[model samples]
Target: MTNASTGQMTPATSGVLLVLAHPALERSRANRALAKAAKGLSGVTFKDLYEIYPDFVIDIESEQAALSAHDVVALQFPLYWYSTPALMKEWLDLVWLHGFAYGEGGEALKGKKLFVACTTGAGAKAYHAHGYNRFSMDEFLRPLEQTAHLCGMVWEAPFVVHGAAVKDDAALKAEAERYRARVASLLPAKTEA
Candidate 1:
């Protein structure tokens, strides 16, 4: 995508890798809708973590290769107990190793971008200081932000779909469209090869 201020196309050689992690994909309406929306976009790769590794054994080398091939990494999941699903956490711990993702000689992800898209059961109003959940989504996602920092990736503002459980069909579809647009917007403009 071209930057609005500079009118320069973003230098994205590889494209985006959208990693989806939902323990129960069939049971999650919001996550299903969101994933469906992002399925066929150009320059985007959609991967389902649970589907790939049901045994909870992640392929670190493969995961790192995928990351290396993508200019942007998008994590899509349903918020569970204010954190990510167990498999997603496992993927992070296993794939983002010290020598590869952080510590000395860990410059593999230095210029990559990290984006997060999450669905929450509670409404937006419930994620505030005076609200029921008692913390904003950004606050809940601090760990992820820090992870990006440590990996030397640029942390993008997250895209959140709140009140997912109660949203009507129309609202859910609208949210899905919004998600599609957001993901598409991250793509870099076409350049001559």
Candidate 2:
């Protein structure tokens, strides 16, 4: 599959890891439910960054090992200041090192797939230029898109749930179900088994 930003591509593979980094998971109803689904599913690893490294001292080797084990890497978070949360950015900075994720001899992530599952407070209508958010989701995701390309990984289209804050519990549950299906469906067949 071709990345949205760079047009670089990689064939899909098995075993997915959903890296969740929500600063306020306590207040996250939809994301928490979606993460619960991933936890229930066998073979899909849900690594909650905030819970794992509250001090921001990420273990690089361990993080690299996790990346190596999974064919599909999902960056799951709420759009904070139109970008990833602080710890998530720290993950990219610390874990995606020059000789590991990119640069010379950086073949670790080649052929792997990276996807973003993001939440926005505003509805879809507000993402347009004429709307309040003033930019498309794709536009907001350029860093991830280019980063995936540099790492020789395929960037899948993001799975986004807009207007998450005021969504009813029933609606959130249904959205969670759809989120589960979407993540499940996106998994490589071998992993799906």
Candidate 3:
């Protein structure tokens, strides 16, 4: 796989870690489908935050271990109030610690890849300068991009399913398939021994 920003080839053994953060995943058609699609792919470790941490008490050591094990970290979530869910924020605050993810001696995430996949209730048109949201998706995702940079992680182009709430069954399925393919493409190609 080639890095999206650098146009450089990635290691053949790089694995992927997909973290899904949806508080009400059962009610979200888009997130559920995407999670199902991603969970079946090879070289991907999928985790459902809400399912594992219903109490919002995250295991910092386990989360850090998962991050260290994978070369690519994909965050899958819905646009909750134009940002990640409260639990995800809490996890980041706790897991991404000063000496682990940043600051002095915090080189664990360096050279890793960060990918963001999100679903928005409003359509693409609604997230423009003159649209209802008055900001583009890129604008809203700046913080994540910056976070990736701060941790020395390469930022990949985000995958978004706009107007997710209104997409019909077929459209939603297609989006999920596309997301699966996109995530798969990020995985390193296996080599025969």
Candidate 4:
């Protein structure tokens, strides 16, 4: 708990947990690479939510336990309907219990960190004021940010790769590299006073 009380993350930080929730990893490109880069790091836990609960039945207890074990928690998936995939929503609703994630006595996530990495079929230019998506990505993500705040977690700037469907391998690789680094950078202090 010493690390949890300090706001500085050491190389010995507990771990980074990446939760993957894409509907189909076999058909994915960008998400796949991003998840791959995060795999096998000593202090990293890569959990594929969809793969575990394909029918959308999230394990609240297990997930809560996972959350309790990590310093940095990443929610990685494709952008759907301007937010997260349905299973993710279901997962959130079930796993982020009131007394655990947020409530009068809920402090399980206090001082923890949240980071999001997503890809969209509509390129970067589309998620703007007049773009096809009609709103900035950040704007679409307010609910999530507020949720993190409510749970006493710190929200990091999202790492997004728009136009995911058609980006070339090199382009996708570059984005993946950025995603890896960004995820790596999210390892915050081990403890927060």
Q: What is the lDDT of residue 92 in candidate 1?
A: 94
Expressed as tens digits, the lDDT of each residue in 1-193 for candidate 4 is 3445576563433678888889988999888988898765556788898889988877789888889888778899899888999988898899888999999778888888888888888978888999988899999999899999999998988888888889999998898788777776775544444
Instruction: Report the Cα RMSD per candidate.
Output: 5.5, 7.7, 6.2, 4.7
lDDT of 1 by residue, 1-193 (tens): 5667888985545778999999999999989999999878989988999999999999899899888878889999999999899999999999999989999988778889999999998899999999999999999999999999999999999999998999999999999999999989887666664
Better of 1 and 2 by TM-score: 1
Measured with C-alpha atoms, the lDDT of residue 89 in candidate 3 is 87
* Model 3 lDDT at residue 41: 94
**CA error at residue 74 for candidate 3, angstroms:** 0.3
Ranking by lDDT: 1, 3, 2, 4
**Residues 28-61 of candidate 3: C-alpha lDDT, one tens digit per residue:** 9989999899889989998999999999999999
In model 4, how many backbone clashes occur? 13
Q: Clashes in model 3: which pairs?
A: none
**Residue 132 in candidate 1, Cα distance off native in Å:** 1.3
TM-score of predicted structure 1: 0.92
- Model 4 worst lDDT run, 10 consecutive residues: 1-10
Q: Global CA lDDT of candidate 1, please?
A: 0.91
lDDT of 2 by residue, 1-193 (tens): 4456777764433578899999999999988988887657755878999999999999999999889878889999999999999999999999999999989988889998998999999999999899998999999999999999999999998999999998999988988898888788767774211
Cα error, residue 95 of model 4, in Å, equals 0.7
